[model samples]
Target: MRYVREFKGFAGIRLESDDIGTADDPSIILLHGFGQTRKIWEDVAVGLEQAGRHVINVDLRGHGGSDWPSDARYDFDAYVEDLRAVLGQMRTRPVVVAAMHSGWIATAALAEDAATLASGLILVDPQSESGAQSVRACAEELSASVGQGLAKPDYDERLLDIFDVDGSGARLLDSAPHINIPVLVVRGALGSGHRAENSTGYADAFPNAEAINVDGGGLLVNAERTEAFNGLLIDFLERKQPRFIPEYRSGSDARTLRDAMGCFATGITIITAHDADGKPIGLTANSFTSVSLDPPLLLVCIANNAGSAETLRSAQSFAVNVLQIGQQPVSNLFAGKGEDRFAGTRWEVGEYGAPILPSSLGIFECTRNALHEAGDHFLLVGKVEKASFEPRRDPLLYFRGKYRRLHFT
Candidate 1:
């Protein structure tokens, strides 16, 4: 099912949207390029809906059924603000799918608060960081290709004003590091205006991002190769595993179940404690999650055969250090069998007598609360005694058998 709705956008402009699929499904917000409307996403939205996703195709201000403000305040900031307003209205955080000029707006928005606003990002044929001259040339070409009957008479002219203004492209470059969400950059193999350098640049800026080119596709890659685009989009979503769906069943293969569980991304942590001999012992683990808040409880599973298993089992207290993006080497160090893991690692003794890694994204000092036998692993539950985190640091992530960094939305 699909329906049209209006949203209050930036500067009092009314943005129109086509809402599709069931409200209970995972949400995906699609933004079209300049001089285009929400209708451009019709085919893509249909495919997404079929895959059990709720899709919202939005028309930016000054285009399609959206209000064309007489004030003529169409700039990069204005576009970003409009998108922010639309996201604010969604019931859940959505995976933003943006193309060309709209991709610029999405980048700026994600740079501001990626952790809170978006779950993932898909940028198609994003606009290049070319100067005003290139933009003006592109505007002229677009105006000629799209006749008066196709777009608003003033769209091209107003769009030129936006491109001519300096700083939007620079801001995008500066804000790239702040985007801490998974991102996919898709470009058309034979596209113009969407430069290869710019596409690769976006991927390089992000902590966790990958780039791909669609064969025989141009600027409108989604429309040109609908099937390929849909497949790519769906695969990325499944790997991200934004919303957990229970699929437990009896008699499932152990390896298969483990593979399925890997779909759920988790932060890497090093569980540290002092053994009976007062030696600092630690092991890398991703099987750590909060269990309770009122009593501040958490748990980490350690393999019974692990070198530190006996130390952890006998320890009265421990610390879980959530690694940062810069700590991949540290995680590797602790995951290995031998070689002094803490020899060069900078750490300090916490109140609970556990070694707390320096510069970790988060540290949870805990008192050993309980231990339970589970298959080949022992579940060690802990009551958190103290917790601290670095707000500016991005977490080290693991998904689908690989280490991942947060890609700014």
Candidate 2:
């Protein structure tokens, strides 16, 4: 739990995360639901860090570890003012805003001025109370609930305490169409307040935005089905991951490898397997190419990572799960750091004893067809296993080191 430096003019809890990377990295500021604190985001922070993003999950005013103002004026402007202060200390313009419940209130307050403050907005299932009467009644109920908790002071259970079933409504959801930032609304499958069309309404309002519905779990979804939620979040971020041309490359300076790869756009794949010692391992490569129509066979080139590569060379059996567009984060997870990436990801073993993510464009449970030496990586061929794919949603295509979302404008 990090303390946020106070804004002299504002009076509220300044909860912060120590996501101290470079000052310029895009940041996510999470606002907890009403009656909750920043602690609810612990697992989320871990997932975001693994995906290489800084996250700040904070306790709003009148909640855990934050200061409650003596002023009874509980209007949202005051909350927005508090956010302004937090954003002031935060780096650069166009920050990302993620809000749930009461945090949605703060997000809406800022959406009217998004170009001035944020690049994107993510609103979790929010309260959507419409009329002034509903707002007044909801405000009274909200005040009493927080007052009761404040009177006691032993409210240590942040999740159970804050998420005690207030349910969502329009009282909290601003006229979403008025929100100007690119928005991503996340709803739990159960106990969610915002209806499906409600999100669509918000999406329609914003010219450059989309909405996603998750089924793994409600308001308690993210922590419940961490893997599915993580996968979905990862997929979303990868599709949204900024495409930037880096200034320098280590080996070849002239044409650059990325530029060369750009010439012949290819499919990217991250292959994984256990070593002879039965330890999990994986690596990333863009050399995954389709080869054949009648039999349906695919190929992957694996670098000499301690992971399944060695085992593949020896066992000659593995599963190839072709990733759809925006699955780059999962690929990175399998390719990059951490000893427990599999634990957080959902997968099932194929008949051949290889693990594969449940949803993939192609699933190849094959005996090692052949292996050949490549430059530094090995070409491991796999025959088709039980394959499945969601038609219309295209697989991600890469070339010259850029990921493009295939959609007709």
Candidate 3:
């Protein structure tokens, strides 16, 4: 069964979508590229519904049945906010599938809160980084096609002049690492002209992403290779956005158990102290908690084989620096190998002689209270001698093995 559905988009604008399949099933939202309407997803929607998924094929602002804003606001941010509004209104998080230029909107919309918005993402023939000249060329081609009656005037022509692509590519690149959900990038012949290195870099930016090349498929892979594209889509959905929940019993693979543990979000921290050689050493850790308030006790678990584990164990004092949103690069530097972590960071000695990252959201200077050996790791408990926190800063969070920011309602 299929019917038309209306959604309240950015600024309460009415956006239209083709609602297919039963609502009980897993859901998917399909977004088309510029100069196209939701009608382009007709065949794909039917295929997804038959495969036990609900589908919402959307018409962006100024296209198809959706409201074309009288304000003529067709900027990139408008499109991004529209998608986020649609996701917020959905009963369940759906896997978003976008083609060509729409991929930029989908990625930007989900970048900040991917785990909360959508379960997965699929990009079809996404551009690496389209410049102003490339966009103008595309507009000229679209106009020529429309003049020759090769395309229908289904969208507003004013969008060509108003839709801004400036700085969008760089923003997309910076947003990639934050979109931690499963992403499938399907490259077709349409983007063959894009530099291979840039294309690879774009796809690799996502922490959890896969890419496939559809050779010989024309500009529009969905239209030219419908069957093949549908096959890949179904397969990714089954694996990443499965209908059933995953369960892990004891004694299963350690990886599965680790994944289960990753579900619990924790604040990121850097355990810092000076080794016997009077050199500052630190490593990123999330296994930290305050054990007692009466005695001001806290504990951090470190892998036994870690380079800093021995030094930290013998040290009389150490500092736990709770990171903030601006210190993600610092966290990476401490976690990474073969880098002078202190050389790249700003720091000062705490009252307890421990290296404290001054800009951290919170700092706990502690004296070594106790140490115990846990399986594969050592528990380093400390008696907090002093503590300081920045009340105005937000914490950096970690969840499901990915970095996340605190999302405010």
Screening candidate 1 with a backbone cut-off below 3 angstroms (N, C-alpha, C), the clashing residue pairs are 179-408, 180-408, 181-407
Q: After superposition, how far is residue 161 of candidate 1 from its true place, in Å?
A: 2.5
What is the TM-score of candidate 1?
0.55
- The full ranking of all candidates by lDDT, starting with the best, is 3, 1, 2
Per-model TM-score on C-alpha atoms: 0.55, 0.49, 0.55
Q: Would you give me the overall lDDT of model 2?
A: 0.56
Please state the error at residue 271 of candidate 3 in Å: 78
Tens digit of per-residue lDDT, candidate 3, span 13-52: 9999999999989999999777777876777787798677
- How many residue pairs of model 1 clash at the backbone? 3
**Would you give me the overall lDDT of model 3?**
0.85
Cα lDDT tens digits for candidate 1, 1-409: 8899888888768889998999888899999767566665677788798776899899887777888778777877888889999888888889999977677789998898987988988888776665323445544544454232355544435665554336667877777778889999887622443344555666887788888776654444434566777878888887874445656576866777887888899999999999898889999999998999988899999999999999999899999999999999999999986789999799889988999997899999999999999989999999999999999988899987779888531
Which RMSD values do the candidates have, in order? 19.6, 11.8, 20.1
Which has the greatest lDDT? 3
User: Candidate 2, after superposition: displacement of residue 237 in Å?
Assistant: 3.6
